[model samples]
Target: MAFNPPPKMTAMAAAAGTYKANLSALQLLMRGLYGGAYIAIGAALCTVCSTGVAAHLGPGIGKLIGGAVFPVGLIAIVITGVELFTGDCMLVPLAAMMKKINFGMVLKNWICVYIGNLIGSIWYAYLMAVGPLVSGHADGMLAVNAFGITAINIAVAKTLTYKAVGAAGMWSCFMKAIGCNFLVNIAILLAICADNVVGKFFGIWFPIMAFVSSGFEHCVANMYFLPAGIFLNHWHPETTARIGGLLQHFGGLTWGDMWLWNELPATIGNIFGGFFFIGAMYYFFYRKEVPKG
Candidate 1:
C-alpha cells in the first residue's frame, strides 16, 4: 500500500505543475524555430520555380509567379508542415510580449530558427541557380533559361530589390511594400489562429496572394531567394564584374549597395510591419478577451 503524504506534499505538487507549464512554454518556442527552418526550405524551392517560370514567362509575369508559388509554400506550411518565420513573427512575438513565455526561451527559438531559415535559403538558391537540376528542365531548360535570364534580368531584379530594400526611389512605393507586408502578416497569423482548416487556408493563401500580386516585400522569403540569384550570377566572374561595374557606372551601385542598400532596410520595415500590423494589433483587438497568463 502507498503511504499517505503530508500537507507539504500537496505544495510540492503545485510546484511541479508550475514547472511543467514553463516546460511546455519552452516546447512551444522550439516549435517556432522548427517551423522557421521548414518555411525557408519551402521558399527556396518556390523561388527556384518562380525564377525558372519568370525566365520563361518573362519578367512581366514575375509578379504572377510570386503570387502563385508562395501560396503553395504556405500550404506546405499549414498542411504538410514547414518552418515559417513569418507566421512565427506574429505568434512567437505575441507570446513573448504577453509573458506567456520566458524571454530567453523566446529569443533562443527565434535566433535559432532565423539562422536555420537563412542557411536553408542560401543552400537552395545555390542549387537552383547553379545546380544542373535547374538547368535540366524540359524543352532545353538550361540553354534558354541562361540565355533569357542573363544580362537583361539583372536590371529588373535590381529595381525590385530597391523597392524591397526600403530606398523606394519614392516614399509611396516603400509605403506600398510596407502595407503589403502588413496585410500578409495579418492574414498569416489569423489563418494560424483560426479554428478550422479551411479558415486557416483562406487566411494564409489570400493575403499571400495579395502581397505577391501587389509586388510587396517579404523579407524572410526574399532573404532566401534573392541571394540565390546573386550567388548564381557570381558563378561567372567576368559577368559578375561587368555587372558590378555596370551597376556602378549606370546605377551607381556597389557591393554594399545591393544588400545593405535594399535588403537591410526592407528587413527592418518587415519587422515593423509585421509587429504593428499583425502581432500587436491582433493582441489588442482580438486577444483582449483571452485570459491573461
Candidate 2:
C-alpha cells in the first residue's frame, strides 16, 4: 500500500477538519452516539479479555491485552464515518486554524458531539450492566461477575486514586490526558496518511495500543468505563465490599466523583493535547504548504 507524504497528509487532515465543520448538529450528534458506543464496545472487550490475565501472565501483559483490543472502537469509528469527540478536538480546531471554518462552528461541533458521546457511552454502560457483566443463577437473579468486578476496580482506580492525592493527583490525571490525545491524534494522522484499509488499520492501531497500555486517560473512553463500573456497583452494592482499596476508601463511585476526579480534568487536558499539541503544531509546520482552496 502507498503512503502519503507528510505535506500531503497534513492537507488531508485539514480537509477532514473542514468536512466535519460542515456537518449539522443532528448529524454530529447521531455520529457522536455511534462513536461513543463503538468505543464502549472496545472497552467492554478489553475488560472481559483481560480478566485474570494479570494473575496468569503479568500486569504488563494484561495491559497489553486490553490495549490491543481497545483499538477496535477507533477503527470502527474511522471506517464508519462517526464523530468522536476526542478526534474532533484535533480535526475541528485544525479546520478553524486553516480558515476553512470559524471558531463558532468548531465549538458547535464539540458541544454537540460531546453531549452525544456521553449519552451513547452511558447507554452502552446500561447494556453491559444488564448483560455480560452479570450472570444468571438458579434463583433467576443476576449477579455481578468477574468482569463486573474488574469494571468497578477500573472505575475506582480512575477516579478515587486521583482524588486521594488532591491537587497532585489531578495534575497527574491532566498530564496523562495530554499524553493520551497526543498519541490519539498521531493515530488519526497516520490513518489519514494511509491510502488503503490495511494501512489505515495498522496506522491507527499502534499509537492507540501504546496509549492504553501506558495508562493514559481518555475522556470519551472514561465516559463509558466509569459509568459501567458505577452501574455495576449501584446494582450490586455487595461489589463495593468486594473491592478493597480506593473504592472502599472513597465510599464507592458516584457521578460527582467520576467528573470531578477524572472526566473534567481529562476533558480539559484532552483539548490542550489534541488542539495545541497536535493540531496547532501541525498547522504551524504545514500552513504555508497547505493547498489553497
Candidate 3:
C-alpha cells in the first residue's frame, strides 16, 4: 500500500517522536544544525529566484514561484532524518502525550535543537551575505546586487515594518507564523502517510507551497533571511542607500530588532500551531484508535 490509514499514521508519529526523544544531546544538535542549513539553502534559493520577478511577472506570480521552490529544504530534512525545531515542536510533545517521553525531555530537545538551528542559520547567512548575495566583493567595495537588495527588502519588511505597526504588527506576525506551522505540520503528517519516495515528495511539496504563497512567517527560514539582510546593511551600506522604495522605512536594522519584532513572536506562534493545532488535536482524535504496544 502507498498510504497508511489515519490511526496507523498517528501511531507512527508517536513512535517517531519517541525515537527523537531518545537521541543523545550531541546527536540532536548535530542533526538540528544540518536541518537549519538545509532550510537556509531553500530560503536563499527562493530569494534568488524571486528577485526582480515581480517586475517581470506580477507580485502574486512571483510569490508562487518562490513557494513552489521552497519545499526542497523540508523534503531533504524529512528524507535525510535531520532535526528541525518547528517539526520537533510537535513531535516531542506528541511523544509526551503518548506517555513515551516526559516534559523535561521535550524541553531539553527543544532548547538544544533551537540553539543548533540558530548557529547553523547565522553561519549560512554570513556565507550568503558575503558570497552569492554580494558576488564576492570586498567588504568596503561590496555592492548590493539585486538578490542582496531583495534580501534587505525581506528583512526590513519582516522586522521594521512590523515594528512600525506596534502591537498590531506583532499580532499579525504571530498569526502568520501560526498559519505557517499549521500547514508545515500537516505536510509532515502527509509525508508520514506516504510509503514511497514519490509519495513523500508530493506530500511535502504542496502544503509548503501554499504556506509560502500565502505570505506566512516561518521562524527557521527567517533566522537566515533576517541575518542575511542585516549583514547586507552593514557590509553594503552604500548599496542600501541607493535603494528607495521600501528601503526608506528600513533606516537601520539591528539584531535586536530582528529578534524582538519577528523571530521571537514567530517562534512562539509556531509552537502553538504545531503543538496544539496539529499535534495535540491529531493525538487526541486518534488516541482511542491507536493500537496498543
Candidate 4:
C-alpha cells in the first residue's frame, strides 16, 4: 500500500532520445490494433467472469475468485504485440515531447492505435453477441456456456453502487477515477521496465488489484462486456409471461437498464479517469528528458 510515483522523463532527454521504435508506420499501426484487441478482450473476460463469480457466490467469494487469478492478458497486451491506445497514446506523446520521440510520429501512433482499438472493440462486441459458441450454450445452464449468461452479471452493477458514492456530480467522481487510473498506468509501465517476471507480476498486480478493489471504470472493457452481456441477456421477453427471468431475476430491471444507467456514466468516468486527467496531467508534469517507463 505505499504509493510510488512513476518515473519521469526530463525535457532535454525526452527530446534527445527520439528512438523511432524501429517500427515502421505500418508496423506501428498494426501494433496499435493488436494492443487494442487484446486489451478489449481481456477486459471483457475479466469483467464478465469476475462479476459472475460475485453474483453466484456472494461478494466475499466473488471478490476472491476475481482477485486470486492473474490475468495473463496483461502480459499479452505488452508481449504478445501492440501499442494499446489506453497506454501508448498516453506515453508516446510524452516521450516525443520529452525528446524521446518525434511529436508527429507519436501523434500518428496515437491516432492509428486509437482508431484500431475502436474497430477491434466493435468487432469483438458483435462476435460475442451473435456467435454460435454462445448460442449453443444459451439453451442450457451449461458450464461451457458461462459467457452466454454472464454479460450483465454482478460484475458491473455492483460497480455502479460503488461509483454512485463517488459521483458527487461528474467532476468529483471523475476526479477520483482519474487518480485511480493514473496509478494503474504507472504500475503497468513500471512492470514492463522490471527485469524479472516476479518483479513484473508484482508491479502489474499492485495497480490492477487496486483498480479492481477500488472499483474504477475501464472504458474499453465496458465497451465490450456491457454490450455483449446485455445483448445476450435480451433474449427473454416479459410479454411471454414465462419471461425467462431476464426481467425479474436479472435483478429486476434487465440488461438494458444496466447499460443505460451504469455503462454510460462509467465510460465517461473512464475517459476522464485515464485519458484527460491522468494522461494530460502527466504530460503537464513531464520534464521531457527521461523515458516514460
Candidate 5:
C-alpha cells in the first residue's frame, strides 16, 4: 500500500513510539547523536547556499533555496532510523497518551536524546567554525569570510534580537517554534503513512521545507545554528564589529544568551506544538477509528 489511513498511521506511530521507549539509554544517546549531526549538516548547507543570495535573488528566493536543501538531514534521519529529539517530542508523548509507554519512559527518552543532540550539535559547530567557516584559517589570524559573517548574523538575530524586545521577542520565538514542530511532526506522521522509500522522502520533505521557508524556529536545528555563530564570534572579533549596532544592546553572543534567549523558549514551544497540537489531537481524532483486534 502506498499510504496508510489516519487510524493506521496513528497505530503505526504508537507502535514506533513504544519501540523507541524500549531502547536502552545508550542506544538512544548514540542514535540521537547521529540525528543531531545530520540536522546540523542540513543547517550548514542552508547557511552556505543561502549566503548573499538575498542580495541577488531576493529574500523570498533565498529562503526558498535554503528550505529546499534543508530537508536532507530530516530525510536521512527518517530513512536511517536515527533518534531525533524534536520528533520524539511528539512520538513519545503520543505513546504515553495511548498507554503504550509510561510518562517516565517518555521523560527518560527525552532527556537522553536531548543531551545527546546537544553534544553532537556543538561538536559539529566547532568543526564547522574551524574548518569551512574559515577555510582552515588559524583562529583570529585571518579575516572572516562571508559565510562566517552570515553565521554570526544568524546567531545575533536568533538571540539578541529577541533579547531587545524583552518578553515579546521571547514570545515570538515561542510561537515560531510551535509552528516549526507542528510541521515537523506532521512530516513524521506523513513518513509513517507511507510504505515506500520515495513516498517517505516526499512526505518528510514538504513540511520541513514549509517550516524553514516560513521562518519558523526549530530547537534542534538551532542547536547547531546558534552555537556555530557563537564559535565564529569567539574566534573572530573582527566579525562582531561587522555586525555593529545590536552588539551594544546584547553585549555580544554568549552561551548564556543562546540558551536563555532562544534554545530554552524554542524547546518549550516545540514540546507544546508537537505533543499537544499534533500528537494528542491526532490520537483523539483517530482513536475510535483504529481497527480493534
Candidate 6:
C-alpha cells in the first residue's frame, strides 16, 4: 500500500524539477546524451523485435510489442536521473510553477538537454545504419535487411505522409506529438508515485507502452528514427529504392523533410502537451495543498 499522495507526488516532482533545472550545462548535456542513447536503445530494440510481427500477428499486436519495449529507455532516463527534452517539458515547468526556478532556468535545461538528445539519437542512428541494419558482402558492398526496411518505412511514414497532406498532415503530426508527451509526463508522474523499483518499473511501463502503441509522435524518438532511416538510405540506395513509390510519392526522406514534417512540429507539440496538460494542470490542482517550504 505504499504510494505518494497526489500532492506529495506533485511536490516531489517540483523538487526533482528544481534539481534538474539547476544542473550545469555540462551535466544536463551529458545526462541528456545518456537519455537520448537510452531512448534510442529502446527504439532500436522495438524496431528489431517488432520486425515482421505485423505480418504474423497483425499491426495492432506489432504496435503493442514495439510499445512494450520502448519504455526501457524512459525507465533508464528516470531511474538514472538524466535529462530528456520531453520529460523536461513537464519537469522544469513544474519547478517553475512552484517558484523553485525561473523560466530562464527552464529554457536552459530544455535547450541543452534537447541538443544532447539530438546528438545521442543521431549517434546511435549512425551505429544502427552501419551496424545491424546492414550486412557486408565479401565484395565490400552492404545491404539492408528486414529491420532496415522497417526503419526506412518508419522514417518515410513519419515524414512523407505528413508532407503529402500539407497543413493537415502537419496538424496530425502535432496532435500525435501532444498525445505522446501527455502520456510521457504521466509516466514520469507515475514513476514518482512509486516507492520501489518494481513499482516504478510497471508505473513507467504502461503509459509509455500505450503512447508508442497508439502511434503518437515523440520528437526525441524521431531524432533517432528519422536519421536512422536517412542513414540507411544513404548507406544503401538499392534498398532505399526498394521502398518504391512511397519514396517518390512523398519526395523521399531528406533532412529538410525530417525537420519540417516531424521534428519541428513534434517539439512544439510536446512542449504544449507536457507543460500545459500535465505540469500546469497538476500544479493548479495540487499547488495549495503542497506542503510549504
Q: lDDT tens string, model 4, 177-232?
A: 56555755665556645656666667776676666555555545455555555555
Query: Would you estimate the TM-scores of all the predictions?
Result: 0.67, 0.98, 0.96, 0.65, 0.97, 0.98
Q: Per-residue error at 191 for model 6, in Å? A: 0.3
Name the regions of candidate 5 deviating beyond 4 angstroms. Answer: 136-140
Looking at model 1, residue 92 earns an lDDT score of 58
Sorted on TM-score, highest at the top, how do the candidates line up? 2, 6, 5, 3, 1, 4
Kindly report which residue stretches of model 3 are placed more than 4 angstroms away from their true locations once superposed. 136-140, 245-250
Estimate the overall C-alpha local distance difference test score of candidate 5: 0.90
How much lDDT does each candidate structure score? 0.52, 0.93, 0.90, 0.52, 0.90, 0.93
Better of 4 and 5 by TM-score: 5
Candidate 6 wrongly placed segments (more than 4 Å): none
Over 25-113, each residue of candidate 6 has an lDDT whose tens digit, in order, gives 99999999989999999999989989999999999999999999999999998888788999999989999989999999999999999
Give the winner by TM-score: 1 or 4. Answer: 1
Error of 2 at 32 (Å): 0.3
Q: Model 3, range 30-142, lDDT digits (tens) per residue?
A: 88998899899889999999998899899999999999999999999999999999998888899999999999999989988888888888889999998889764565565
Compose the digit string of candidate 5's lDDT tens values, residues 77-107: 9999998998998898888888878999999
lDDT of 1: 0.52
lDDT of 2 by residue, 15-112 (tens): 89899989999999999998999999989998999899999999999999999999999999998889999999998899899888899999999999
